[model samples]
Target: MGAATTVAQNMSLCDKYTTALLKDNNATNQYTLMILLVNTAVIGNYTTTPAPKNAVPGILANGTFDGKAVNLLPYFDGSLLSSNRGGSSGVSVNFLDGGGAEPLKKNLPANDKNSHQYTLLTHLYEFFGVLLQCSEYNKNPAFPAYAGHDMESAHRFMDLSPSEVGYFIQQVGLSAASFGVSQEDVTAVGNSLNKLFGYRCSPPTVVVPEQGETLNSICQNEMCPLDEKARCDLYPNNGTVVEPARVNGTGNSTGNGTGMGMPNATASGTPGFSGAANRMGEGVISLLGALAFVVAL
Candidate 1:
C-alpha cells in the first residue's frame, strides 16, 4: 500500500484499539501496554533519556532467532542505539547502530554504557516478557531453569504483519516511505511488535487433560490447566494446589487477562548481565530485525 494509505489504515486501527481498550473492561492488559508503548513512540516520549530517574532495567526475554543472547533494557542507552527526534510527530526512535564501536556489555567503559541497543519494539518485548515472566511455567519461579524463554515463539504470539506495520508507521506519523522499500522490513517490525504485545498462541507445549477430563486428576503432567474453569489449586485430589497466575494485576488468573506483573527476585539474569538470556527462537527473530529496513531500504 502507499504511504498515505498505510498511515490512514494504522490510524484507524489505532483508533479502534483505543476505543476498545477504553470501553472494554476485559481487554488484554499486555496488548494494552503494547498500545500505550506504541502511542508513546508516536508522541515522541522515548522511554528514557540520558539523564536521571531512568526507567528500571528489565530482563531480556530470550535469545534471538539466530541464537544470539540479548541483554535488553527498556530505553535506548545510546550504545547500541542512535536516536533521531525528527519525525513529523517529533517522536524519537531508537535505531540500531550496526557500526557501533563498543562491544556488547562486557566490562564496558562509560561511553559504552548503553550503546548498541535493540530497536524500540525489542525493548518493549523484552519488558513484556520480563513483566509476564513468560519463560517460567505458570509464572512460578520454580519452573524454566533458564532465565529467558524462546522469543521467536513470543513473536508468533504477536502475529504482526506488514499491513500492520504500515498502519503503525502512519499512526505514528513516520517519515515518508521512498521507492524500493521491501516488505521484509515492515514484516520484521510487525514481528517485533508481536513479540512486544501480540497474544497469538500456538498448540500447548504441555499435555493438560482435555475439558472433559477431571480437574482433580490432572496434576500428573506438571502442566497447568488451560481451561479457566479446570485450573483450581484447591481441587482435592491433586498435588500442591496452586492459584492461577494473575495478569495486569487484576487478581484473577484466567484466559485473556493481560498478565502484567512486576519483575521480582525470581527473574533470571546475572547481577551485571541483565536478566537471563532470551531463548525465544527464530519464529520470533530479533526485535532489531527491522534494522535492515532502516539501513538498506
Candidate 2:
C-alpha cells in the first residue's frame, strides 16, 4: 500500500477506535492507557518505556503464552507510574531507569539514562501515530522514520523472549478491547500489528516451525505457542519420553489471560505462518496456536 493510503487507513481506524472507546462506560480505566499514551502526542513530546516483570499492570490481562517469563511494563520508580496525572494529557514519560534490577534495562546504557528513553517514547508516540495512520507523523521526515528504532532492533537486546513480546502485543489489543474498542476494530488493529511484527521478526535467529514444529507459527517461531504443534515440537510423539525432574522453577509463571486471545492469521487467513505456495513442508500446520503475536507479539 502507498504511504499516504496506509496513513489514511490508520487514521480512519483510530477514529473508529477512539469513537467507540469514548462511548464505552469503562473506558476511563487503565485499558485506555495505551490509547491515551499514543493518542496524546502533539507535534513534540517526550517518550520511551516498558512493562516491568513483577507486579504486572492490571490493565494487561495475564498472559499464558508458552515462553513468557517477564511482563513488559516500562520501569517505574515508586509512584511515577501510579501517580495520578488526572485528566491532563501531554506526552511526557518520567519512567526511571531500572538499572540492574530490571532485565529490560540490560540493553540500555546506565549513562544514557533518560536520553535514550526519551527517544524511545518519542518514537513510540509517533509510531503509534504511524500505527493509527496519523498523517501528522508524515509532516516531518526527522521524526520516527528519520530517527527511530524498529521494534525488533529496538527491543532485541532487552532480554525479551518471544513470549514477553507476545504478551505486550496481546495486552495492547485486550486492553483496548477492555476499554471498549469494537471487536471488529480491535481485530483489525490486532491483525495489522501481527503482520507488522511478523515482517519485523527477523535478525539473529529466524526459524520457521516446520510442518511438524509449526503451531501455525508466524515470525518464524519467534512467538510460537506450545499447543499440539509446539508441544509435539518440544517433545517426542512417543509417550515413553521421560520428563526431567523440576529442580528449579521458571520465573515466567506469568498467569493472566491467555495470550493473543486473537489468533495471528496468514495472508490467506489460514492458521500458522502465512503464504499458500509455501505449503508442502507446511500444510496449514497446527490445529490451533497463538502467541500474543506482537506488533510485535
Candidate 3:
C-alpha cells in the first residue's frame, strides 16, 4: 500500500490515543492544539522539500518563523533557484546530500522570473484555515463550556483533522522521496511531532466530547490557553483570535463564529492550502517529466 494509505490506516489508533489523553480533566485543550500545530509543521515540511530553489537563501536553514518564510515553499517561483546560480546553466538538481552541504539543485527553472511548478505556502494557508475552524468550535459558548470561560471561537481556525494531517505528512514524504531526501530526514520530522505532542498514534475510541465536557467548555478551559507562539511557529498568520460566544447548551450564535459542523467552519479556500496542493502537483508532474527525460537519454 502507498505511504498515504498506511498513514491513513494508522490514524484510527492516533485518534484513540488522543481521546484517552483528553479524557483526563487535567489534560488541557492546549495539548490537542499543540498536536495539531506540530503535525502541521511536519506535514508542511514534507509537502515542500529541500526548500524551494527560489526561496530566500538560508531561510529554511535559519529555522525562523517570521510569518513570511516559515512553511512557504509552494508560493515561491522555481526560477529563483536559477537566479541564485546566475542562470539556468548554473543550476543543477542533484539528489543525496553530501560534502557537508545541501544537495545540488536538479529541478530548478532556467530563469528567475518563470512561474513555479508548485507553491508550498498555499497548502499551509489552507491548513491553517482548517485549524482556525477547529479553534472556533472549541471556543463557542453556545455549546457547553469546558473550562470556566465561554467558548473562545478559536477552534474554528483549524479546518484539517488529525487524520487529514497525517495524510498530508505522508504526501510530503512521497514528494521528498522524489528528491531523494534521506530516510533520516523524513523520519526525523515524524519523530519530532510524535515527541512534541506525546502523540498516541492510535485511533480515538470516542470522537465526541467527554462526559460533562461541553464543546464550549473544552474550548475555553482546555484549548484556548495553548500558546500562540506554538501555532505561529507552524504556520504564519495563524493563532489569531476571532470573536467569542456563549456556552448555553442551544448552539445559536452571532457574527462569523465557528461551531461544530458549521458551514465554512474550516472551509478549504485558504490560499496556503490550495497553493501547496497546486505546487506539489506541479512538482509531481516535473518529476514525471524528469523520469521521461532520463529514459530518453
Candidate 4:
C-alpha cells in the first residue's frame, strides 16, 4: 500500500513536471522532461488504463493534422513564394534576354504535387515516434504502474511506424525545399528530438561508508562548556539532539509587522497574494491599449 501511494504521488508530480516541460522553450529542458517521464515509467508502479485506438483523433477531427485544419502546406510550399514587394508566384526564373515572352505564370510541379503530402506525413511520423517510445516505456515492468496498458495502442490510433518515421523526415526536407520556415525553427525542433532520445546517464560519483562506522560514532574527545552541560541535563537519556537557545539580540524577530519584513502584496499589484482581480484589470488595460493603438495607426 505504501508503494502504491508513493507511486500515485510520483505520477501526479510527473504530470505537473511534464506540463511545465512542454511549456519550456529550451530543447534540453524538454528532453530532460521526457527523460524524467521515461525514468518514472521505468521506476514507478502504475495502474494500466485502456486507451482508444486513435491516439490523435482530436488532431485529425479538428483538421489540425490535415491541410483542412492547420494548413501546414502553406508554411512549407516553396512554389507559393511571396516577394518583398508583395508579389506572389510559384517559382522565379530568369529567362534569356531574347524577345520571347516570359513563361506563363505557373507553380513548380515538384513543390505543389509532392512536397505538401511529404511534409505533412513527416511531421506525423516524428510525432508518432515520440508517442511510441512513451508507450514502450509504459509497457516495461521496471515501471509496474503502466504494466496493464498497451503502449502500442497509440500506433493503432496514429497508424505510423519506424519506416514511416524516416519517410516523414525525408518529407520534411522536401517540404522545406518549397515553403521556407526559418532554418532556425527547423533546426531547433530537430535538435530537440535528437537530444531527447540520445542522452545517457553517467555512473555514480560518490560511495557511502559502512553502517557500523556511520552509526557507532557518539561523543569523541570534544570538550564541552559548562552551559552546554547544563542544557544536556534537561534531556539526559533522550536520543534527540537539543538545540541551544540564542543568547543575544531580538532573536528571530522581524521588524516588519508580517514578521518576514516583506510587503504582503501580490506580484500582480493586487492587495492579496491571490491577485485574480489585478490580473483581470491588467488584461483589460492591455486589450484597450492594443485596440487604441490599432485604431490610431
**Predicted structure with the largest TM-score when compared to the true one:** 2
Give candidate 4 misplaced runs (Cα > 4 Å).
1-152, 156-163, 195-297
lDDT of every model, 2 decimals:
0.25, 0.30, 0.24, 0.21
For candidate 4, give the lDDT: 0.21
Minimal lDDT window, size 10, model 3: 288-297
What value does the lDDT take at residue 283 in candidate 2? 16
C-alpha TM-scores of all predictions: 0.20, 0.40, 0.21, 0.17
Model 3 Cα lDDT, one tens digit per residue, 145-179: 22211111212222222332222333333333333
Q: What is the per-residue lDDT of model 1 for residues 115-207, given as tens digits with 9 covering 90 to 100?
A: 333333334433333322232223443221222223322121112233222222222221111111123333434553443322222222221
Off by over 4 Å in 3: 1-156, 197-297
lDDT of 4 by residue, 1-297 (tens): 112222323232223233333333233333333332221111111112211111111110111111111211111222122111112222211111111111101111112223333222222322322332232232333211211111111111111222222222322222221111223323434533322211111111111111111111111101211221222222223223222222233222222211111222111332321232223222211111111000000
Residue-level lDDT of model 2, residues 172-288, one tens digit each, is 433333233334444444543443343323222221211112112233332333222222232222111121111133222233322312222221222221122112111111100
Candidate 1: Cα lDDT at 182? 23
